[model samples]
Target: MKFTTAIATAILASAAMAAPERGLASRVKARAAAARGSRPLEAAQKPADTTNKTNVQYSSNWSGAVLENPPSASATYTAVTGTFTVPEPTGSGSGSSSASAWVGIDGDTYSDAILQTGVDFTVTDGEASFDAWYEWLPDYAYDFSGIDIAAGDEIVAIVESYSSSSGIAIIENKSNGQKVSKKLSAPDSSSHLGGINAEWIVEDFEENGSLVDLVDFGTVTFTGAEAKAANGESVGVSGATVIDIAQGSQVVTDVTIDGDSEVTVRYV
Candidate 1:
């Protein structure tokens, strides 16, 4: 009798397990049928890498942010403007150390030539000086006359490319409201300005043929940066590239972009 009762209980338990399995199978089938009538799910895809896609190749002579047009665009960038503080050179080097901040058209990825204007800061034997200058590179920069610039002056630099070979550069001392504008004519050359890109750069400028010593300029923030295309459209800093000047692993200076128009460069 005991053996018969145990067998019956075991059969009932097995039946209970089979009943839930059957119910679960039915529910799963119902869900599958409903899903089949709905839209098919898409497979997951990985996000794209923006860091590698939107980047500027770094050079030892430059540390700044540069904005370029789309690859297909034959854009003729017309104007670029920004404001920056003259950074004081404080590096522990024996010789003179210098840094320059400027806004200009071309000379990034699309053109080897640059038409730029800004202020240069230099420190030699613990003395610091500031001078306003303009350059159409492959040529020496020319200094503006009759304007006195000192360190800590807030400056507005504007470069307007009016045509393929003509432009104007303006440098203003925001604190004193003193400013100067000069009409520029690019010297005869094969490398005409393509006007493909615009930049806010802090550069280790070259004298003769060598990179000048970079100054410890703390940080120079460029605000209110504006660039316009030939179509009168407001060009922005999207898809722009940030670069840091490095000597092997030792980064000398770095740059950052804020929002779509502001850039800041720092001596690291």
Candidate 2:
């Protein structure tokens, strides 16, 4: 089964109408024009061979830690949460660069759907800007208004899947004591969540049908990272797979998981 084009169109239209303004509309519109949002890892290599080893993979668009295999075969991840300090993105030259850090469920091993939210940091001609947003892929991200974010601000992102077809995405600006959330539903039955994998990712997302230039987002560390399964078990990044961003021949990011509850990604 596939998402009905008519229904998807209506949903997008409704979301656009309800979107916040004050230059936010243009930002959201720019994102909505993208081909896709947060996506599954495009692994460049296979997993490592050592037991209890950190399986390191490389992707063109994503760099972070993913809990792909659940502890229990019957358990499906239903909720994921993480907190990070917004990075100060530095511009390389006279162009725009962007990146986003988010926590999501079911986009790694199970790619049919993803429930996620986070903040996007961008640098244009040496000026920096931040926008908080939520996304349910394959739909584009929508900006969350009324929450002000800046470099050094602490942010907590949470995504919860109530069912295959329903979920919620939340972003809390802990530094400023502001919060925003949205309850979302799958565009169609075929776009339902699989709830198999959970991830804390720093991503170079698509814009205008191409991957945008990733800014030098010095470092982002996801702390208090946790995922809850449908069977009521909670897990961390202890045994998760680590991924780094590799653009062409040179890897651009470094990912490391510290203990079980922390994952850090650094731009190289």
lDDT scores in order: 0.71, 0.86
lDDT of 1 by residue, 65-143 (tens): 7776633365568899999877666755445677778888877675556788988777766667677877776456767
Candidate 2 residue pairs that clash = none
**Top candidate, metric lDDT:** 2
lDDT of 2 by residue, 44-129 (tens): 64325322325787788889999887767678889999999999898866767889999998787788878889988988767788
TM-score of 1: 0.76
Candidate 2: residue 66 lDDT (0-100): 90
RMSD vs true structure, all candidates:
28.2, 10.4
lDDT of 2 at 268: 88
Predicted candidate 1, C-alpha RMSD: 28.2
